[model samples]
Target: MLKRLLCLILLCAALPAAAWDNRGHRLTGELAHDRLQASDPAAVQAIVAIMARHPDKARFDRNLAGLTGEARTRRLFGLMARWPDDVRDTPADRPDWHYALKIVHGWTALDWYTAGKAEAQWAANLATARNAAAPPAQRAVALCWLLHIGGDMHQPLHRGHRLDGSWLKSDRAGTIAWVRRGPGLPPMELHQLWDKVFDPTGVDGGDENGDVTRLHAAFAPRAAAMVPDGGFVQWRDESEILARDSAYTGPALRATKAPAEAPPMTAAYMTMLRTIAERRVIAAGVRMGAALQGLR
Candidate 1:
């Protein structure tokens, strides 16, 4: 029994990180879009029209091809919800808009401001989401960030950067924060692994929107558990805590040790990480709904 338990632990600890990935973004988008659909159809319509004119509308439409009716509409909203991340190369991209801080163990807004980073762009982007006074096109752009950043900020890595000695070396929020749980697994980014978690396995073949629906269903309970009263700051604080507790600590430290040694993965550890990933995604979706409705 002891040996079997040890083996299970090894398998679990080896699981990858999750964040900044498209599928996770899409789930948050779809979940937020669903909330808006129920509470503010007009906001939904306005967003749909704006997405129609997205700088990369051609690609969005291509993704929409071959769908119809409610499915088309749901998929459209899901796509719109995630559209901002897809336009990184276009002029529409706002690099700072995606993250608020390179957080430390006990970071404050002052620390972020001192580092010359905005407290949170999503807060300001809300103006565009709320501004009926602004042109529809402009508001649509801000709305994308509002939706996109809600999910982005929930990513533990996004709220904080890993420190190396006295200097910050977060590897671009873990784009380069590599890890190796054991010998058999390939080296992977801490951020990339988190982003890859919660992906829908055995999804309805190629019908990605169906996968979106399925994902929302899977995460709905996690979203319910969030019950947030504040906004980005609340979420950011939670993510920052998770970063310290899970992302930067644990097997990660030993995984990259000088002796090239580390602890093994365990099922218990894997469950804890999954819980964090699912909860963050769901919380982002729920808060996004409130943010969208509040704008309207």
Candidate 2:
């Protein structure tokens, strides 16, 4: 009886720490790497140089967080889906639930809400580049960052409200709760499943033994195939199609159904989350390219 009780306690303790690790930051790095690989060699070099100069991983993550559109949604969905059951139940109010779903999920909603602002920003950038006769390289870099960040902002999890332990709060924000073992699952669980639908290998990174360049190079063809010679508008259209067909459709359908029990956050879910993070990174790359093209 003591052994069983100890095991239970151990499992319970392990839950929160596991939850803290599931965020878009991990995936964004891989996505950025993938985008650079798919890009023109010169562009890739330029981005790398810029990244090296910046040195602030948090800034990079924050920049990625600002992205919008389907790319953001898809990535967030991936992260949420793979979030550990224990972490998913962790509330935003709890400091230990550091990666609690609040900021990430809230950012997702905010992405939708502020999409127009993003569009306007793109337009303004384009105008500035055109009128000021900015160098193509400068214009391109700006455009790339814009697209990347916009996609980040669009992720639903990023837009989630921080539930400060308010009982009346409609949105759970960053709160941990018990996974009810029953036929009807909670909204949090539903949200989690939707986040993990993408394949992790598709995005890139995660393997210490893996060659990022090779991995990114391998996926370049698919990302490039999605791009037309003309540029960003085509990329935007492709992203929209992905959003409508893949990101929104799968989750919307699954969310309608109830789970028998709150699913445990498993390795499989982590894998799935990793995959979505990679894709979001890829989507940001594509969007960045598109934003630049619009400037031209």
Candidate 3:
């Protein structure tokens, strides 16, 4: 019995990590785009150079592996909610570039509630790291990952609630839930609405051509409009409210009568989801650029 229990404990421990693997690909793609648009040209150049250095897909995967959970999640979400300060003072010692990368990566994952505190800490750490300075190559890699993660954190679904139907549990009101059931099923509450049911239909699928890019272009403007113009506290409050109201509607919660599972796929829903995702991706890029610029 003890051995069986230990095995069960180990299996439970591995679940989060396993879940992370499924989502990490999209997250990494988002961060890479964010880093390329950093306000600091030197920083952008530095990041790109680093990415060029290790063309190995495995290294990129490994870097992403370190960016899951609450702390990092909070930081990434915060970047979207507000801008960074430009005040600068060189520090005496530089921390590990990898460490700094992780810090920034995590910071980008922040949401509205944790944004204020996390932003402050990120500023301090960034200053210290800047003072310790890396060659253009390493800095570039760090910056890119930071930007990518920041974008990932902002997708309404990414900053979901914990208890009332968020990613961790299967209440089906966030990205995790939507992803589990591709399309065509009854929507999983607000998340499905946001992810796949909010928009008009007929825009769902495309040939393998440049459909993704075209989709990104379509929603960029709306997303840019959604970027909040306020302080971290304000953003956090807004995020909290959004999570409570939209993602966890009372009517939706009461409707659940069985164990959770993915919904069926439908062309109409897929089209709606694509539109929503396009808007989110564009907004993420614009907001990340604004945050890096330290603009209000």
Candidate 4:
């Protein structure tokens, strides 16, 4: 039964979705690593030791085995932060782990909540993770979820798809809104653009083992100050509303239910989108950094 369940989840992985590209996840992990370490050094050490058993052990070592002193520690913590996404491709991974059901607005719980939701799992996993007596492997898995899914929940789209009686389906959290990069530039999915674009317009940080320089938390000062003292539900509450935000709004966006035309993504709109995307990335980092209280 467990193997069958894992197979089902693996099929769901065919759908495309990424809350924050590697860089964004890395940034969030770094901030959270620092936040937890500064106040609870031992907690950070304990988590990292377990993560050393991450299913992808060889990759973890080859990529994160450089630097010295605090630099090495931060980088490992940052990489472990992204470990969950890697799990998405593994058989035992949770296909729905990257997102939660919309928990805001009128959707208060009555007893119908699914344990599979990222909101539920991250919080529950925190408790599992804090229990050092649990199997080391179980604790390691929980740590990855707390880091990766915790960050993903902060991404507004991942809060949940919005479908009012219409077919827009919240444009699949902006994925259906095909955006033209410039007047004649190659177009891409609006959601993907948000995932890929950078602050100040064109800061290109290669996503690789050596990409830590640009992924540093110091690069985003405003985000560092925006960390909130909250948990999974609060993070979802904050991000779920952004579906209606201007970045995801437009005539083309509204018609995405069935057959629809691509949106005319304007330069001004692109600039505004960049701004909102940057802030969201920063906020994810800040909140994810401070979100480790229970697990720590």
Candidate 5:
């Protein structure tokens, strides 16, 4: 049992970093799917048809096996949101497209930023998705990327990477700022901590459907207020503000300067992180829904 558990942790650590874990990504997709269904059922139909033309349609089919109708559609949308992370290091992977790192040092925003092509890639994919003349399979791939990247942009860490005095280099969205959840716990990347905040006990091990339903209901009241009225640029900027003001506060900032070992995150800090993370996830879902509704 001990050996098996160790292996699981190692395997998890080997996985590439993403804006959110599978459960959070699924929730974002599910919410967007629901929004699209309510406002434009025809758009949902169109999206489903386009997804059927994906080059990896067989892979999708395998995952959707034994499921049908609404359940299948909802799960497929969630899969769409997670597909990019699933295909990392493949020819289709665009690692840089996952983040637009507005660098910071301490409390000050730096003038220089990394060449994160999230904005450009998102626009390109959107154009392809909307272009009637584009090949069906190509458009299908574009649509998948659109779903994934839309969620990526709303993750605050994906929007900024800090430059700590200790390193004088970007933390690469907190990938290196290892932190402990409690005393004697194994060190985990700060990025990983935030990524799994929504599904801490493991998405598969928890009540994912219930959590999704709960999150959607909780945020539904704020849906009208959370829409990205100013567009993707505005969404990116909002995440940057949160990353600076919320994510990089106090204990998280201190972890950056720790010499070697991962520092412990305060209990109060963890509580606050959870609140910010939940809000960000809902905002991402709402904005993604709006983007899909705009699809021609």
Candidate 6:
């Protein structure tokens, strides 16, 4: 029993700290695609053209074999959102670019550099996506990052991580903080719980049509109202606040060293988590659309 528990702990610890899974990223991208069609038809065409020049366009073509017309383009855009994650372990892999894990310390400006390079990467990628002097293929990659990082920025855990008390250092954005979702269920990482809060089954409700349409219809109005005027740094700061106030609440923060002894998330906590996850997904979509609309 001791050996099994230790193995499980090591397995959980090694799980990748991805901000949002494939479903979340795809939903955000699809919603943004729909928004662009409704608000900026020309930009939609421009973006599609740009994405055509992506270095992995052939792979995209193979995956989108039967898809054509608007369906093909929309799905293509969604694939771009997942490209950054898909390229992991390859030459293009940039693990640190996915998050900006700001330590919740009272450190001075001199120590701010200790945080991940996500914010700086965001600025650089946005500039690349907008720079006409750059190659079309390069802009396509940057555009993909914009779609992806926008979703990451809204994930509370991706912005700030706990370091005090039970965590002598950090939870690595909850990737190592094991917890139970319910009685008799196996222990799972806290970050994975939040990553799948919107789609707990990990299959998007097994709906053939997917969750983008349903989520967009349900949260479009709220997302529109909440969309920022524009400021990536400000958006990240909002997530940091949510991490401290919402994500680190209840039994989650009371993590102990034992995986088998991990606490179960309460019904109320799950309710709150789903609500925040829904808002973040829709907001990320609308914001991505708004950012793309600026393309000349």
Q: Residue 260 lDDT in model 2?
A: 40
Cα lDDT tens digits for candidate 3, 29-61: 333344334344454443334444432334444
lDDT of 6 by residue, 1-296 (tens): 43233323322333244777777787788778877877888888888888889998887888679987988877877788878988889898887788877645222121242345678888899999988788999999999998999888889988876654355445767888888776677777888888876565643356523665566567656655664456787778888888878998887876556789888888988888888888777878888888888675
Where model 3 places Cα greater than 4 Å from the true spot, the runs are 1-43, 54-132, 135-141, 162-209, 221-228, 231-236, 254-280, 294-296
**lDDT top scorer:** 6
TM-score-best of 4 and 5: 5
Worst 10 residues of 5 by lDDT: 7-16
Instruction: For candidate 2, write residues 1-296 as lDDT tens digits.
Output: 43233223322232212211223322433443344444544454443443333323343344348656534433332232222221234441222222212222212332222112334444554454344365554544343334333443334332232211221231332123222212343334423333332323322226421343354455445555555243434334444443334333322222322344334444544454446545544554454444333222
Steric collisions counted per model: 12, 47, 30, 1, 0, 0
Report the lDDT tens digits of candidate 4 across residue range 158-206: 7644333342123445566565555554556666666666432322344
Candidate 5 TM-score, true structure as reference: 0.85
lDDT tens digits by residue: candidate 1, 1-296: 43233323322221212244667788887777666677777777767776665666787789889988656766775676577767766777655556654545322222333121224467677876688787766777777777777888788877665434322332445555556433555565556556666544312135565556787777765665555468767887888788778876666554342233324445565677778887787777778877877454
Q: Each candidate's lDDT (Cα)?
A: 0.62, 0.35, 0.34, 0.61, 0.74, 0.75
Quote the RMSD, in angstroms, for model 4.
6.4
Off by over 4 Å in 6: 1-17, 105-114, 202-209, 220-228
Which pairs clash (backbone N, Cα, C closer than 3 Å) in model 4?
32-289
Q: In candidate 2, how many Å is residue 45 off?
A: 5.6
Per-residue alpha-carbon lDDT of model 5 for 1-296, expressed as tens digits?
A: 43233223322232224888877788778777877777778888888988989999998999789989988898888888888888888887877778776654452434344446789989999899888689889988988888788888888888876654453445667887778765676677778778888764632368766776676577656664654566789888888888888788877876643535788888888898888777767777776777777454
Please give the distance, in angstroms, between residue 141's alpha carbon in candidate 1 and its true position after superposition.
Answer: 1.4
* Candidate 4 local distance difference test against the native: 0.61
Report model 1's TM-score to 2 decimal places: 0.78
Local error of candidate 3 at 291, Å?
Answer: 3.1
Residue 58 deviation, candidate 6, in Å?
2.7
TM-score per candidate, in order?
0.78, 0.36, 0.45, 0.77, 0.85, 0.86
lDDT of 4 at 86: 66
